[model samples]
Target: MVPKGDLAAVLASLLPAPGSGGLVGADALRCARALGVDGVAVSVTVGSGLNELLWSTPGVSTQLEDLQFTLGEGPGPEVAASGTAVSVPDLVREPVDRWPVLLPEALALGIRAVFCLPLLAGSACLGTMTLQRARPGPLEEMPLADAWIVTHALTAALVQDAGQWAAFAAAEDGSDFYRAAVHQATGMISVQAGVSLAEALIRLRAHAFRHGRPLNEVAEDVVARRVHFRHDDGDGRAPLAGGGTEGP
Candidate 1:
């Protein structure tokens, strides 16, 4: 169990420093681990992208999270949309058909239970803090309390990073790092395949989903002229010729 005073100390220590930004990613995971929970992830929505700040477990991958975003469905989206805590204490035993695609994917990755808490300050939502356990069970009260503490810590960090927030928000809506490449690739694919940009984006996502690769990595390949999206067989796929996909 997490002591209230320890939680307070953790929050207080997180408030002021050059290390604050880095601390935001590790603190919750450490707290969860210390309190004997399985894993923790911190995610924030900036513009149209939900960037995962930190992930503490190997079972849930960035690929899985991208699947949620590309498909525009999942517990993360639901929590972000509703600004409410969503807990699925048992993913394997839950109604299988509810999230058709996500449930099976999560279960395949060995995630048995999940908890999400919205990161909010007043009426504004930053994102969500998600906790996952390998075994199916509910999060005890102390961990939940610590999760709330982590949320408030994130809020405080956001308040401190107001200037950075403005800069990030003012940047082009979908132009961050590899996102711009993805958009450009989407446009190119749309023109090539005789489809709309929306369809092109879906196709791009489908390729990434099918191949189990991150969309950003695939987009980088498309941008650098290393690969091309094709629909020769009525399915969109990128077949690379020479070079391997690399980070930007």
Candidate 2:
């Protein structure tokens, strides 16, 4: 069951329905603060090696979320790999090797602590809810539980709401029609590169990140037959037409 908190009400009251350039990340940060975190961010998987920032509290949290996406290592992936909450009371005090790239950078951001809670769909871990604090210390047991509740409720709102259940649940076009081009791009690349769906997404995201572009923009290109993954290494080097796929 989803966490029973005032978040559902808040989401209903504040979030823009479906994809009006609303809900998702903005609401995610709002709900996280309601649960008493200094900052909150949501990371959702679009494919292997691919996840997007669904929402984040303004300021440092948002920057950190972007950092995680760009660096490819952090509590985001740790929680996904471990399938459990990652509580770092004080990043400065922890071993430096633990988060080599992310740690040094996060310290520069004045983030003393973090907690990453998993967002699950049955047995599959879909994403994570990451909260941060300026002061170093572990999250109290009670708020930790609250964080879990919020994670469940938030994932429900982002993924299961309104009968939309594709990988991302919305289209980039913001139209009345739903288009899972991102999801299609993932699968299309999977077959094109002969890799698992997850690995395929990772490749796509890498290309987007290297070029300093958004994943959806890259996905749109793939869907339009402008890009294709011809080799199995997951490189976006394949150039062929009419190899795109669409979602149901």
Report, for every candidate in turn, its global Cα lDDT versus the true structure: 0.66, 0.70
Model 2 CA deviation exceeding 4 Å by range: 1-29, 162-172, 175-248
lDDT of 2 by residue, 1-248 (tens): 65456565545554446556544533655566666668887777655555766667777887787667656789998888767878899998889888787898788888999989899877778888899998888888777877777777776776555544442245435432212566688888888767787667677767665565555667888878687875634445443221333222
TM-score of each: 0.72, 0.63
Model 2 accuracy (lDDT, Cα): 0.70
Candidate 2, pairs of clashing residues: 25-54, 25-55, 48-198, 48-202
Q: For candidate 1, lDDT tens digit of each residue in 91-196?
A: 8777977688888878877778888888898977778777777788898887788788777777777677665555455653421332556778888777666677
Model 1, poorest ten-residue lDDT window?
A: 239-248
Worst 10 residues of 2 by lDDT: 239-248
Each candidate structure's count of clashing pairs? 0, 4
